[model samples]
Target: MRDDEFLAERFEAHRGQLRAVARRMLGSAAEAEDAVQEAWVRMSRSDTTHVDNLGGWLTTVVGRVCLDMLRSRRSRAEQPLEPEAPVPAAVPDPEQDVLLADSVGSALLVVLDTLTPAERLAFVLHDLFAVPYDGIADVIGKSPAATRQLASRARRRVRGARSADSDHVTPARRRELVDAFLAAAREGDFEGLLDVLDPDVVVRTEAGVTTGASAVAKGAATYSRHMVGVPVPALVDGATGIALLRDGRVERTLAFTFVHDRISVIDITTDRERAARLKITLL
Candidate 1:
């Protein structure tokens, strides 16, 4: 085989793994594919004659590409543009798609969205993929120690979000918390809102992210005063949450993540297109 053909074969061997890393970092399948393609393009043009581990080199390349994409994405407005039609797959595999989505739970994706680009890159690479801190630091232009700290912070946030599934927090109790949150919001009860929110609670929406219990509670109280439609309990992405219905049609959805008995995260979906895509089952 020619030298180029040999290189292509090696790249194809790692494509699946590279795509998985990108998918977790980006949270968008299309963007992940783009990042992988960019990595291939860079490798095809560069001289890797001295490279010892091809897999590690390619992973670093994809990490850099994903980091740039994430930073660019954050620089843009919070309101995403209308999604373009997805490119047709050369060979569609619905099962593979389902498996990938299941592996990366929807709640986890929501928590990842709240992280900064650098924090997300460090955590996803080091914690999830086991990429060493030195390599992650190179991708984000930080010292190894700083990179480790980034991962540590991200890990804490992720743990808080996932703690909702702890055995101690029964599904019934979670629902009760959600019910209390809605009741407080509807009543414009600021103190009640604080009672159910974590001290460092985070609320994410297309508009932007708001942190701190007092801040989120203040906003919730203000929104409650002019709120329209009835908010009802629902299952959002397999977790207990709230759905706002107007004239019998769902207009918004809020997914909650509890740490201990207080809510730590609130992922609100208000964009019409995004809201329509959420799996919300009214109770």
Candidate 2:
């Protein structure tokens, strides 16, 4: 075979691995395929006369390309995930794909979205890809200690969210609690809602235009107070509820977490702009 033929064959052999890495980074299968195609083009045109360890070099190139793609795609602060298309029964189940599109997968990705770019990359490489801390440092251009620090913050957030159970409740059970909470919120049922909440249940918000911790607690309380008898409206889907005060319109995003039979936690981020888009009403 000609020299060009050998290179072409090599590309075909490792292309699947490259696509997987790109998909992992990009979070979109279509984008990953496109990135790999572009990488192959760059490889074909380059002067590779002295190139060694083709696979390692290719891996590096693919990772860099993916990082670039991820940066460009970062503007959407809250990424609404697209549902997987229905698969034919004849086709064997795609276990990995199923995992990626399931409730747990969605939960993980949503939590990951809260991390900083550097932190996200570090956590993904270390936890998701099983990359060593030293190598993760290399990819993220941080000292191993710094890399570990980033992962530390990310891990803490994940664990705190997961362990938020006031009572022992599995993930599936917690999801149901969230549904009931949203129902009460929509209907404005403070008594019914508070019934499910521990008297001292924690509700807090991050700083912004909205009132500080004291203020949000009062607002949520007021919501229940005014609507004491009104039934909270039905919440859609009920995966989990996130509230934020939009920068311009609403006072905050009121995100919630559920545990056992009660609403375990409430986190309100005061983003007035997001609130405006969400069209949340504030009394």
Candidate topping TM-score: 1
lDDT by residue (tens digit), candidate 1, 28-87: 777888999999999999998899998899999999998888778866624232233222
Candidate 1 deviant stretches above 4 angstroms: 75-103, 166-200, 207-257, 267-283
**lDDT, candidate 2, at 242:** 41
Error of 2 at 100 (Å): 9.2
Query: Candidate 2 on 87-185: residue-level lDDT in tens?
Result: 221223477456434423433443334445566566555654456777667766779999898777565555545555445666555556655665665
RMSD of each: 7.6, 9.7
Q: State candidate 2's TM-score.
A: 0.53
Clashes of each: 0, 26
| TM-score versus the correct structure, for each prediction | 0.60, 0.53
